[model samples]
Target chain A: MVKKTSQRISVASLDDLVNVAGASQEQEQQYRYHICICVAAGCISQNSDAVRDALIAEVEARGLEDEVQVKGVGCMGLCAAGPLVRVDPDGIVYQSVTVDDVPAILDSLENGPVEKLILPQDIPFFERQQKIVLENCGIIDPEAITEYIAAGGYLALHKALTEMTPSEVIDVVTRSGLRGRGGGGYPAGLKWVTVAKAESETKYVICNADEGDPGAFMDRSVLESDPHRVIEGMAIAGYAVGANKGYIYVRAEYPLAVERLELAIKQARWAGILGNGVFSTTFDFAIEVRLGAGAFVCGEETALIASIEGRRGVPRPRPPYPADYGLWGQPTLINNVETFANVAPIIRNGSDWFAEIGTEKSKGTKVFALAGQIVNTGLIEVPMGITLREIVFDIGGGLPDGRNYKAVQTGGPSGGCVPEQFLDMPVDYESLREVGSFMGSGGMIVMDDSSSMVEVARYFMEFSMTESCGKCIPCRTGTRQMYDLLSKVVAGEASQSELNLLVELGDLLQNTCLCGLGKAAPNPVVSTMQYFEDEYLERLVDDNGSADEPAGES
Target chain B: MPAQATAETSAADKRWKLVEATMRRNGYRPDALIETLHTVQGVFGYIDREALKFVAERLPVSPSQIFGVVTFYHYFQMKPQGRHTCSVCTGTACHIKGSKALLDDIEAHYDLKDGQTTPDDKVSLLTVRCIGACGLAPAAVFDGEVEGSVTPDLLHERLDNWLAEEDEGNGEEN
Candidate 1:
C-alpha cells in the first residue's frame, strides 16, 4: 500500500499551519465506509491488531478496501465492548468484535445491514457522552495528522497563537470554569495566567502523562489515541503562558503510547506546528519527551518535574507551586493529560460555548476512565454537571449481572469514594468535593455489593503507603499508620479506637503532607469510613464464631 | 571432540556473554543476578529460568532471588508469551458472575494453565486484578482487547476460532 502523502499539507511554521488548517474552506467528505477499531492501550492489550487485520482482510475480500478504510483509532467509550469497531458513514457501531465475526460484518457491509451487529441507538453509552476531550478519539486516526486537522484539531492552538492575546486566552479559560483534572481542582486558567504574569524570561509547560492509578488509563488512552490534540493543547498552553519549551512526563510502562506521542511530536515538528517559529509567526515553542520511572508518586507535578530533572521521583514541600518556581527554578505550567485535551475545544468553541454545555460552576466536559463494575468500561467524556447517576446508568450502561450499585471511587487512590446515596449528585469539581470525592485525573472505579469497602480502603491505603515518597512525617508515618489500621479493619482486628485513630491520622495526612500525593493519601480511608462505617462495624462485631478469639487466630 | 560437552560449553559461554552485556546495560554490578534478570526483563520483556540460571552462573546472587524478583513485579514475565496475552479478572465481583467457570472453559479449550502460554504461542492466559470494568464482570482481555460480560461457552468458541485464524497467519507467514 503506497502511503498517501498528498492529503498531507506541509507548512513553513506552526502559526501558518494552524492558520491554514483552521481556516481551510474545503472540508473533506466523510468516507463512504469508515471502520473504526479501538486501538487504545486497553483494547490493544486484547489483540486488537488481529481484529484489525481480520477486519482489513474481510474488507479487502469483499473488494471494499477502496471505498472502506479500516482505521485503527483510540478508545470508543465502551471498553467493555472492545475490541470495538464502528462502521461509518452509516454510524453503525459493533462491539466485542472477534476474528470470527469478521466475515459476517463484511457480508453485512456489502448487504443492507446486520441488525444484530448494529449498536442500539448509538446507545446511552455514546448518546449521553459529551465527547470534548475524547472528541477526536474513535473519530480520527491518531498517527495521521491530516485526520486530526480535518476534525478541527489544532484550531485552538491557531486561535491562541494568532487571534487571542495570552491574557485573553487565559481569561477565556478562566471564565469557562475549567479546573485541574489532576485531583487538585485548581483553576487551569489561573495557573496559566500566573505562569504568564510570573517574572521570568524562560517558562515551561509540562503535560502530566505519568498516570499511575491502577484502574486509570485515561492519560495513556489520550496520549496514544489523540497525541496531536495533546501537543496542540500543550502548544496553546505554552502560547497562553508565554512559555516556549514544554515536556511531556510520560510513564515508561506505556511504551506504545510513548512511541505514538514521540511520532506525533515528530510529525507536528515536521509540519512546523511545533518547532522554531510556529505557523510563520515569531512564537517559538518546542516540546520534548521525558520518560518517568514507574513511581506512582511522580504523578504529582513537583515529583514529575524532579524526575524530568534526573532527580529521584520524590515529592517536595510546596511553598512555591510549579507556576511560581518549577523545572530548574523557572515558572512552569503543569496540567494533566485530560486538562491539556480540554484546551483545544475551549479555544475552538469559545468559553461561553464551552461553558454552556456543562454545569453553571464546572464548565466544559470531563473525560473519565470508567472502570470497575461499570458496563461500558472504557473512556468517556461527559459534561461536567452530569450526575453520577447519568455517568453510571445512562452513559456507563449501569452495572452488569443485575448487581446493585454500591459506590463509585473517583480520582484513584488519592480521591475518595462516593456512595450510592450520592449517585444522583452532579459530578463537578465542587459537587464531587462536597461528597468527599475530588475529580482526580478522571479515574472512576465503580464498586458493587460484593466489594468490601473496608478491603477497598485497605487496598488504597496500601497503595498510598507503598507510594508515599517518604518525604514528610505526616504522609510517611501517617500513611503507614493508616494502612496498618485499615489492614486491621480488613482483618477484623480493629476496635473503635483504632478506627477513630485512622480517621484522625487521615486528617493529619490530608492537612500536612508535603505535596498533593501525601496530602490526598488518606482519601480512601476517610471516604470509606464516612460512607461504609457499617462495614467496619460489621467486621468489628465478628459475625463468625471467632469474636472472642485473638485477631490473628483465624 | 566430545560433541555434547562441546555444545554445552559453547551454549554456556553464549549465555554468560548475554548476561554480562545485560548487566552492563542495566547499571548493576556484574555479580548481581537478580538485578540482571530484572534489567533483562526490562529490556527483553520476560525472564526464562534457563536465562536466569545462565545469568546466575556468572553473577554472585542466587537463582532464587532472580526467580523471586521475576515473580514479584507484575511487569516481569518468566515464559515467552503469545502474540497476545489475555488476563481474565477473577476478582470478587467478576467471580460472582462465573469468572471461574469462564477461566476453566478457556483453560480447557486452550489446553493451558493459568499463566501458561499456548503451544503455538499465539495467546497466554493469566488472572489480573479487577480491570476496573466490573460493570462488565467476567471480563477477559485478549492481547489488550477487554471483552466484558464474558461467558464460558462463548469464550471457548472465541478462543478456538481466534487460534485457528492465528494458525492460518503463521502458515501464510512461513
Candidate 2:
C-alpha cells in the first residue's frame, strides 16, 4: 500500500529533499513486488480502477499484501491494450485486464507469466522508441509525492535553486536544442532568455495545457500520468526566468487531469517545494491553474491570456508578444506542457546529451497521440527525424482489418494531410512543414482508403469555420466562404470557377488572417489539393453537358 | 446595490451555498467569474438567469460581461438539461470509426436532433467535440461514465435502461 503522506513537511535544504527520496525508497524495499495498473483516463474509462480493486482484494485473500503492493499508476502508453497491469522487476505487462483476470494475475505473480494475457514487450510499439518525458509515468503513483521524490523528482529544482545562478540555468537551457513541443517548434531557451532579459518587476511562466486539438491527448495523458513533471518543469522555468508565479491554462474537459494537478500542486506545496521559500533559498515560486472554457481559439497564446483574465478569448497582434506583455501586462514566458516536461531531464542531464538525440535543430523526443485507423491507437513518443512509415507501420502496427492506408492527418485542423509519397520522409518540424503539414501538438489521425480525401478536407474546413473566434473579418468571413466552397464541392454542385475560387480563398486566408488559427485555417484544403487533386476534380461538375462524375470508387 | 441573498432569494437552498463557497474561495474577483460559473453548472447542472445575476452581484463584473463570458465558452450551458444526458464524441478518431452514423441512428430513434432533449424530458442527446478519449473510438458519455467502442445497439440499450429505471422509480427520486 502507498503510504499516506503527512499533511505538511517543510523542506529547508536540498538534503531534506534527498532524505524524503531516500526514506520513500527504503520503505519501498520491504515489498517484493510492485503491481502497477494504469489509472489514466483512457484506462479508467475501461474500468481499470475496478481491476485494481479486484487485484487488491485477491492479494488480501491470498495473504500476499506483504509480498505484493498494488498501486495505481499513470498511462502505460499502449492505451489500446488497457487496463494494463505491469509487474516490476519481471518486466511483464498484462493487456486488457479485467476483474475476472485479477485472480489469475495474482496466481501468475506467484508462479510464472500468464500466457494469453501477456502484452509482449518485444514489439516495435514498445521498442524502437524512447521515453524521456514519460520516464516516471506508469511507474510512480501520481498522487504520491514520495514515489516521485524516490524516482529522483525535484532534484532539478534543488540543483537550480542551490547551485546554479539564474543566468547559468538559462545558459544550459539555451545550449540544449529543445524546441517548443506545442507545434510552433520555437526554441524554448530563446523564449526563457527573452523573458529573463525583459525589464520587468514580475515575470510569469504559463504552461499552456489547453490542448484544444480534437484528438490530441498527449498533454492530457502527461498531466494525468505525471503532473509533477510538468509542475517541476514549470517551477524550474519560473526560477530561470526570475519569475515567482506560474499558471497552467488547461481545458475543463479534462476533469481527471485537473483533479490530479490540483492534488499534485497541493502535495508539492505542503511538502514546501512549490510555495514560498522553496528549498530554503530566498527564491519563492507558486503555480495556479486557470481552467479554459471550451473555446478552440483559446489555444492561441493571446486568446489564452485573454481567457485567463476573465474576458472573451480573442487573439491580438503579436509585435509585443507574451514575452514583453502577458498575463495582466507582466513579461510572461509561455511554453506547452511537453516543452516544460523536457526541462527537468535536460537540466538533470547535460544539454549536449539532449542535443545528440534528434535532428540538428529539433532536439529531444515528441509525444504523438496516435488516433484513428492505427491498430495501436494511443500515445507514443519517438525521437525526432523518425520515418512516418516506421511510425505508421512498425510502431502503430498499421491500420486495423488489413485496410489500405490512404493518408495520415497530422497537427489537427490547423495542419495538412500527409499522403503516401511522404511516408518514407523523416518526421521533424522542418520536414513536416515542407510536406504542407506542421505539427500542431502531435495528434496523428491516420486515414484508410475508405475515407474520402475531398470529404476529409471539407471536414477540417468545417471544424476551422466553427472554431473561428470572429475577431478578424478575414478569418471570420474567409473561413465561412472556404467552408461553403468545400461544402459545395462535397455536394457535387461547384463549377470549375468555384474550385478556383476555393483555391483563391485558401491563399487569401493564409495571407490576411490575423491569428495562427485563421492563417492555417485553409491548410487541410490546400494540402489535399496538392497531393490529391484528383479527388477534388472528380467532385467537380462537367461542362460537356454531362452529369457530375460519379464522385469516387466509394 | 450590493449583490446579496435578499429575502426573496432561496436562503434554504444548499446548492447556492456551494456556489458561494467557490466564489469566496476565489476571492470575489472578476477573474473568478469563469470559475464561479463552472461551480454553478457543476452544482445546478446548468447556469440560469438568476444564477448569472447572482454571480454578477458578487463578482466585480457587470451582468453583460458575465453573460458574454458564459456565452463565449461552449462549456457553459444557459438552459437546464434534461433528466439524463447522452454525450456522443464527434472527434477525429470517433468520427472515422462511424460515430456520425451512430449519432444519426440515435437522432432517428429519439426523433430529436443534436443538443435536443426528448419531449418527455426523459433524455438529452448532445454531440461533444472530443473528450480526448480516442483510444475508445465511437465513444459516448451516458450521465458521466464514458463508454468506449460504443455501437448503436449498446448506446440505445444504456439509454433505454436509464429510462426504464426512472420510470420504475416513478419520479420518487425526482
Candidate 3:
C-alpha cells in the first residue's frame, strides 16, 4: 500500500523518457573534450575538489567553457595516484593533479599532452577490470536522474514488469549464479526465490550497505558514484520479490554516500520509477534509507534488522531466517549493496552473458578494495578466477619501494591471510577456503615483509573484540581472551602454554559463537597460526627458559 | 518563580516541542526511535538524560531502554561536545601507515585519551576504527571534514588553526 505522489508512466513513456533525456544530450553542441575529474571520497580527501574547481575556473578563464567541459565524476580506481583527471575522446589521464597545474592542463588541452603528469591508461589496473557494476561510475553524473534514465537505467524494471513474470525474473538470476558480495557467498537467486515464494502480503527488502570492513570502501564508492544503479536494482528486486517497501541500511560514517543515495531516491520517485503504479502497472515500491550507528555487527542480517527496527544491533539465531520471518515479523529479502547493484545487469544482459564471465561455479566479477603496502591501491572488479598474484602483483603494481611480499589478508576480520606460497591459486570462494580464507566482503590487504603476521592477527582480533555485540559469550569473551594472548605474543611475553591455549580458545569460539561475526572471529588468528607458525614460535618462550622472560630474552 | 527559572523552563519546553514534532513526522511508529534519537541529538548536540527521558515518554518506551539503545550505538553521544572535534582513524590501513603514532601525538598534546573532551572544552579527541579512506592512509575526520595522509606536523597545524578559528568566533582569549 504505497502512497504514490506523482503521475505514473507506462513502458512506452519510459522509452519516451530515454529519448527525452538522450535528445537533450544530443542537442548540446558536442564538446571537443570532456575533462572528468575523480571526485570520489578517496580523491576528495586528497583535494580533487580543488583540482576540479581550478580546472573549471581555468576553462572559464580560457573562454573554452563550451569546447571543454570539466565535470566531477566518480572514482577512477587508481586512488594512490589521485587526484585523477581523465580527458575523454583522447583517453588521456593525469594523476596527482593540483590547482597550480590547472593552467598548464588547459594549455595542454590546446597544445599536445603533458608527458610528466600523464598517467598510463593501459596499465593492468585498468586493463584487468571488467566493469559491469562500475560501467557508468566514472562516466555519468550521478546526481542527475535523467542521465541515468538516458543510459537505460529503469528499462530492466520495465522489462520485468511488462514482459517477465516474477518467477521468470528469479530464474534469470538463479541462472546467473550471482552470490552475495557482502562476505557470505550465499546465492542471490536462491534467497530471492525463498522470499518470493513465502506467503506474506507485507514483505520487506533491505540493502545492507553497512560496510564495516577496515580496508573496504567498494559499497561506499558505488553508493556515492552511481546511486541510481543501486536504486534501479532495488526497484527491480522489489518488483520480482513482491516487496513494496525497501530500506538501505548504510553506515552513518558515510555521510557523502547517504547524501547521494537520498538524492537518488528522491529523483527516482519524482520520475515515477519508485512508488505506486510504476510503469503504470499495479506494482509499488518505496525505498527509505536507515542510517547505521557505527556498529560493525549490524552487517549481519538479523543484527541489521534489529538496527533498522530501532534496537541495539544484536544478531538473533536464524532458522527462521530473514527470508521467512524478519523486520516486524514479516518476510524480508536482505541483500548487500553490491548484490543489489548486480541485479539490473543480470536482467538486461542474459544470464548466459553473466555466467560466461567467471569460473564453473563462481560467476561474474568480484569488486575488491585493494589497500596496504601495494603501489596501485584502489577499487578493482576482477573476474572470479583471477589469481592472487595477478591481483597483488600485476593489478596492484606489487609492493612499494621494492619490498618483499609476505602475505595478503582477505575478508577483513572474518577472513584469513594467504601467504606467498598460495599466490598462484585462483581467488574464488572455494579456493580461498582451501587456502584457509573465505571471500569475506572483498577486502584484500597486502602485507609486505616489514609487517609481522602475528601483529596482523592481533590487529584483526582486536577489531573483532571491539565490534562484538556482546550477545553471545563465546565471541565476546573469546575475542577478548584471544586479543590479550595475541598482545602478549606480540610483546614477546607469552609462554608456549599460552600459545597452545590461544589455539584451543580459537576453536572453541568458532564452534560456540551465536552468529557469523563470532563464528568467523577466529579466522584471522587461526589462519595466521596455520601459515605463519614460525613467527609465533619465535615469539614464544622456550620450554627450558624462565616463564617470566619470553623467548630471545636473557 | 524567579525570572531566570521561568526562562530556563521555557527553553526546555521549546526543546520538547521540537522533539515531539520530530517524533510525529516519523509517524510516531515505535520503529522511529532511532530516528527520533538522531533528530534530538542534532538539535541538542548530545542526548541528555532529560531528552532521553522525554523521548522514552513520547515513543512510549522505558527511559532505561532508550538509554540502552543510545549507549549501545557508537554514533550517539550522551554528553556535550567540545568547541571542535578531531577523529583519528585506526583502521588496518591507517594502523600500518602510523595512525597510532598520530593518535599518540594528539593524546600527548591534549593530555586526554581516546573519546575524551578537554577540561576547558576547547577540543575533543576521538579514535575511530575506520573512516574508509584506505587509499589515503593515516586519515582523520576533523569536524566532519576528512584529512588524509595526516602527519604529526600537519595535524598539529590543523588543530592550532581550529583553535584559532574558535577563538575568533568566541571573541575571547583562553
Off by over 4 Å in 3: A1-12, A27-29, A542-554, B1-18, B164-174
- The residue-by-residue lDDT of candidate 2 on A442-491, one tens digit each, is 89999999998888888888888888999999899999998898888888
lDDT per residue for candidate 1 within B1-174, as digits (tens), equals 111222243365555456466555544443234345545655555777666665655555467765654554454677777766777875434654667677777667667778888877777888764454544566777665667668776677767766776355544675
Q: What's the CA error at residue A121 for candidate 2, in Å?
A: 0.4
Candidate no. 1 TM-score:
0.78
Per-residue error for B168 in candidate 3, Å, reads: 6.2
Which 10 successive residues of model 2 chain B have the least lDDT summed?
A: B1-10
lDDT (tens digit, per residue) of candidate 3 on B1-174: 011222232375676667677678777677788888887887788999877766765675678888889999988998898878898998888887788889888778858778888776778888887888888888999888898889999988977886666454566665
Q: How far off is each candidate at the interface, as Cα RMSD in Å? A: 7.1, 0.9, 0.9
Model 3 in CAPRI terms: which quality? medium
Tens-digit lDDT track of model 3 for A1-554:
00133212223456667775665467333688888898789999989988888888888888887788787788788889999998877889999998898888888877988889999988899998898888888877667665566677778888888899999999999999999988778899999999999998899999999999988889999998899889888888888888999999999899899988998888777767788888778989999999888889999999999999989999999889999999888999999988999999899998999999989888999989988889998888999999999999999999999999999989988899999999999989899998889898888888888889998899899999999999899999999999999998898878887888999999999899999888998999999989888888787766654554435432
**Sort order, DockQ high to low:** 2, 3, 1
Tens digit per residue, CA lDDT, model 1, A1-554: 11345434666645555554554423323346777788875666556779998888877787876677787887676766667788877777876677888888777766866677666755787778777888778877788776687677776777677788988988989888888887677888888888999999999999998877766667877888899999998999898888999999887667788888988888888778888888767899999887664567778888887767644566776769889999999999999888988888888888888778877777778788777776777788888878899988988888878989989888777788899889888888888888888888777878889888887877777777877777788888888898888887777777666667887888888888888877888887788878887787766633353453333221
The DockQ values of the predictions, listed in order, are: 0.11, 0.80, 0.70
RMSD of each: 7.8, 2.2, 4.1
Candidate 1: share of reference interface contacts reproduced? 0.11
Q: By lDDT, rank the candidates, best first.
A: 2, 3, 1
| Candidate achieving the largest lDDT | 2
What TM-scores does chain A show, candidate by candidate in order? 0.92, 0.97, 0.96
